[model samples]
Target: MNLNFITSQISSICSSVWNCIISLDPKVISTIVSIIALAITALTLYANTKNNKKNNFDNLFFHLISLLNKIIISSENNSEKVEITLNDIKKQNKAQLETLKSQKIKEYYEQHKLAVNSRFVELENMYLKIESKKLEKIKKSNNTTDTAVPIRKSEFLSPIDDLDEINTSDRSQVYYSYYQNNTTDEALNYPFDVSDNGIETLLRMTSFKSNPSLAIYNIFNSDGGISQFKANINVLKSEYPQNETIDKINIELSELFLHKNMNIPSEISEDMKKDIVNDILLDNKHGSYFRTVHRILKIILDFSKSEAVLNKYCGILRTQLSERHLIILFYNAQYTDRGKKFKNLVAKMNLWGDNSELDVGANSDAIHFATNNLIWKDKDLKILKEEYVRK
Candidate 1:
């Protein structure tokens, strides 16, 4: 067939159909046109809505996966960070699902829930492995048998000789730069102007209140003072039976004597230092020992006029006590009014440090201890000690 003939035939059929429709009532034609337009518009709107919903679901799904992956990647030995990331996922999951309004999206949410739960399991496993390694490191460090010469009971309990005649106003400054100057091997001989009774009195006074006259304070604040304090405490620990009250008193006295900015001895291998830091961060029972001590120290600091004195005490407490001893001491004070005050102080102190600071002195470990300490309490500490320390 010729092209022209086909075109003319098609045009004639369309003209005939148009004439028939035109010949009908004008009102009927208008109504029919309106119905056709409405149907076309509705179909277009439905297709667009479907496409938009699909895109939204895809975005949500990808976002969920990305967030979870980030959380997994960022989770190292840090339980605190992992917990925070997990909480973010929880919040985002709800918000993401709320914006979606489709059966498909709801199904995706169900699947996402399973995936997230699985990721959390992975995170928990990671935390446990980190914790196990840290505990092992501490166990090795504390495994040494108590082999020092036994302290005589009379030595600790003896009355201060010449207490009435001793010049209290002219207390000599005993320098104890043990760790600061790397003097770990030097005998920690304090100037014996005060007798054993005097030392005991000072220790007792430290347990109850701050006493600047305590010659031990000078020892604790000095460089390498931590080692000296540790040596002294170990002596006491050996002499006395494992009385919780005695342990508590020793810890309190140690806190009063140590410096706040004291560093771990350089002789300690980098690996050991790393282990200590990890333990401090992850091991709830033993690691948290300093936290409870810090809480008590905060109360003391609140009323203390000398920052130098308080920091030294904190330093000694942080450095000298074993993880086991710290846990016991923390429990002893956990129920006291001062313990509650310490908890509140830790929360407030956590927000004070800057991550970019290079000087370890400038970024005090006290703040970190305070921040992490708030995470667990007496019950948690007890469980951790029973599970990790006792074993």
Candidate 2:
């Protein structure tokens, strides 16, 4: 009896629930379904937007890091190229700061700033090392000329020797003392006039007084003398027979009228004249000796007749000499107090513009410019301190 009553009640309840759903408003049910569907769509859109932004930021971040790594690996010899790449990355970083508004990226950059700075320093250090090695090689090459036996004070000498005797000891003392006491302040104050020919100007600018003409004579008068010079000439002629400059040098030197005392031939070709000149100026074995002779010729030769020849010779010599002097100056700048000041000037000038203000674009530009140009003028330093430095 209880089972029958329970079954009838369950049937009546199910029929009542079915009748209620059938009698409900179709519009209201449709509206409820629509709202639920709309909610789900909104949630999906929001999730996709968020993910897209994160992905964009990540792509940019990794790309910048990759550029930096490439610079570290391949930009050893080309600082200018590195500066450009770094600037591009900095621009991207600044853009991220503006658009993505991601604190994670800023944190990432801060953490890696040291690494970036160290890499740049490493590049510059590598360049300095290479340049130093090159200079050492040149000095060693010159030292080969020292094989010439020392001439006695009584040997045939010019008035310049008398002057050398009087100043040699004093000049040496002054040079040594300057090396010991050289300060950054003094270096900064030291006048460097770039208006004159780079060689003469550089020589005059040095703290030590040296006579280029006398230096050349000493090399020319070395052990084997003129005979050894002729042998060096012959070797160079054979080695570079077709070289135009060497031929020209040989022709000019062979002119009997040009070197009446030495009895040089009169019928030499212009090509041989150039070749002879090249032997003296560029031959590795006798180049140092020839360089000295060239310098002496500049002093004694009739400028009117030899002007064209001398000009060509000087152009090559100047280029080579300027490079050597620049390397030396760069080396000195690194080790001297004056150099430190120069470096500080570079550092200050290079800092992100107005460190306190945080202008990413401007700062990026400054870093690029500073790293690219290690040497700065007073005007540049002044502008950097006044315009870019944090008060």
Candidate 2 lDDT tens digits, 1-391 = 6999999999999999888767879997788679999999999999999789657644654454344334334434133433443344335434534343234323433444454334323322332343344334544554434232211111112122122222222222221111112121112211222221111122233311353322222223334333443454454455446646544543433331122433323233334323333332232222222223223323322332343544443333333322222222222223233234433432322123344322225345332233233222233334444643434
Q: Best-fitting candidate, measured by lDDT? A: 1
- Kindly list the per-residue Cα lDDT of model 1 for residues 313-388, writing each as its tens digit: 4444334433333333333233233344444443332122223221134345333233233223333334333322
Q: Which 10-residue span in candidate 1 carries the lowest summed lDDT?
A: 175-184
Off by over 4 Å in 1: 1-5, 76-391
lDDT, candidates in the order shown: 0.39, 0.36
Give the Å error, residue 143, model 1: 66
Candidate 2: deviation at residue 294, Å?
Answer: 49
User: What are the models' TM-scores?
Assistant: 0.19, 0.20
